[model samples]
Target: MSDHAVSGVPGGPVRESRDVADLMRWFGDAWVLPLLVGGTSLVIGILLIVWPNVTVTAVAVLFGVYLLIYGVFRLIESFAADEAGGTARVLLALLGVLSIVVGVLCLRNILQTVVLLALLLGLFWLVGGIIQVVAAILQRSRPHRGLTMVSGVLAVLAGVVVLSYPGISLLVLTVFLGIWLVVYGVLMILGAFRLRAAGRRSVEVTGGAAAAPAG
Candidate 1:
């Protein structure tokens, strides 16, 4: 007998089936915004690298505003969780406080934060691309090797692109990021409906079977 038959569970969660497609489209769609963010950060880093004197004031203002909003959201989320006695409530509260502190520190040292983030993102892409390349190479003998290799190449290319052009503006990156998130959100909603449809079909089939037995 099938697992579904044994368990009598009509359908699996919608998230699992649609997660891959949704995430892919999301990332693909939001590519521009992330690029913009990276570009902006790169520009800021370059400015700081060239003109350290102006870095302090620019960073201080930008970091302060970012942290203030982030901290507020974190604190509210933590407080709500704590009130509900959710698991890790205390941890959430602590994290909220920590984020607030970090935000304050960022305000004080915004230039440094931007530099660090840029470096980290660049390094991450390089490393991730390398890993994908290795995986694809290892799978070269497999049936789907061509597809896998292409994917790996694309990943590597994207990483290289980011590394090559790190001075794009943040606004553009934000927009790109927004596009992908919206795509994923829509996909997720669609997946839920698909799951519902599957469920209805299953029920109709089962009802037909039961009624036939009675007849």
Candidate 2:
């Protein structure tokens, strides 16, 4: 429900930007982190909003895939969270495990999996938002710290709302899920570009791109 890049390659910045998802590496291909997560989230969000009639099985599969991708990236992000030190890294790692667990929960009947997700999504987002806030706090001087913190707060609010209304109708839940993914994806994509720019700046000054952000 919530999450948070740079590129290294030949060609002008124009061509380089297209390497948005060349690989999932965090340091050299730092851009991959957000782009992959953001791109997938955006696609899922669009599907949920525009294709409400889509089969539950299809949505469940896609959701599972998203969780797997998110888990992998988050696990790596935990390692890259240098500024936040060990505590933040550990929390991110645990969150990654949780994501993976839910993804693997796909083995259950499709309907059951979907219902479980609907119920668990709030807790997932709540924990993720808390981790984000903590990471931002630790890296007090990071660019956009205030905005990041605010977004984390928003995530917490969204989680609380969803949790408070567990019996929210399917249509309402779908809309909620769609809107959440869209906003989260847009923020991640924007952050990716910011990272790309920062990487360019680093390359100019120190002959290398900036490292990935802390989780």
Candidate 3:
């Protein structure tokens, strides 16, 4: 059984063709989700960095919330992307699930040890980054593929750094994570603009198709 999810206009027929821009048209903005994801990430990243007297428990809670929010968005993107291949969708879905699970674990403080928390966050970023890279690669036709790939690579590096020095102090870890988030958030914002451009192209294609004479 295939796990493919088709895209289309809300309250309308599902389109088998990946080229259909129903969502883009009906939603009045194809790039909305990306913008939301980027915007939120950027905000949270900034908060984590500049906030005074940030404690371990606060960091854990904030990080957990970010994870849950990001996971939900990723899951939505995975299923709603008709243009994405099944494998890509699956990878994204897995990332979402992993993120959510990690978020829950963080919030619940299931692992009381500081080391364990570091390990968990590191693993999440590591796996999620790899999945993003792979999915970006597989999505050959997507706009801003390079941007996405860059984002993934940054994530992977951040993860590696965290894992390599799991014993790092709160100040060091907080600053590092903040820096990564800011950069990644900027890239995602750029990617969202690129997606907007793609949406415009989709509109043109759809218009041309509609204008074609019937056989």
Candidate 4:
């Protein structure tokens, strides 16, 4: 029996299938949005790096803006993953909320925000480094495993330095944050292109299936 017949209701299965296909298409096409966000992030990071002498208030405002944009983008991406369902969606939503809240707080009080942001940055780097290191170990057969391990080590050391010197001047913190942001933005842009390619492949597959003759 065909999927439509298995659904046991006229037009139900076909409609549902079409809906899912449409959602996938939408998700794939939406990759451009993330690319734009990443590009903006790169610009901000560059600005921070170039003008490291900017005031604390300026840096705080910039960070808040970046966080707000990041949070909103994350929420959109999470919602788009509706098919994932359950725990994954909930966790993504929670992360989005946390980012938004932290962003708002940063905007409200620049001085306090600096310290909190420093701590958060350090923790993020530390956790990310550990994950990278673990991933490198697991994928030892990969050609670039050595480079990945080295990157991970550097990330861990950077995290430690940030945490150990949390009281560092705002200029120094900005420089560190700027460098990380630039790297992250480049990764995001690369991911966007990948998504775009995947979307095209999905469309091609769906088209082929639709054109195929029924037995």
Best by TM-score: 3
Instruction: Go through the candidates in order and give the clash count of each.
Output: 9, 3, 0, 0
lDDT of 2 by residue, 1-215 (tens): 22211222346442443443232123435766878898998999898899776555666667678888888987987787676678777877886887787776643464554456566677777877887788668755344456557767877888898888877666677778778888877777776676666555545543233233334
Runs of candidate 1 with Cα error greater than 4 angstroms are 1-164
For model 2 the local lDDT of residue 6 reads 22
TM-score of 4: 0.74
lDDT of 3 by residue, 6-31 (tens): 22353332342323556556433757
Ranking by lDDT: 3, 4, 2, 1
Q: How many angstroms is residue 16 displaced in model 2 relative to the true structure, after the best TM-score fit?
A: 26
* Candidate 2 TM-score, true structure as reference: 0.74
Question: Per-residue lDDT for 55-147 in model 4, tens only?
Answer: 776876786787788778767855765544545455456555656776676677645555776776576557556655665565433333455
For 126-203, candidate 1 gives per-residue lDDT tens digits of 554454345445432223234434543554564465567566444433332233223323333343344345445545
lDDT of each: 0.42, 0.68, 0.78, 0.69
State in Å the error of residue 122, model 4. 3.6
Please list the Cα RMSD from the true structure of every candidate, rounded to 1 decimal place.
13.8, 11.2, 7.0, 5.5
Error of 4 at 138 (Å): 16
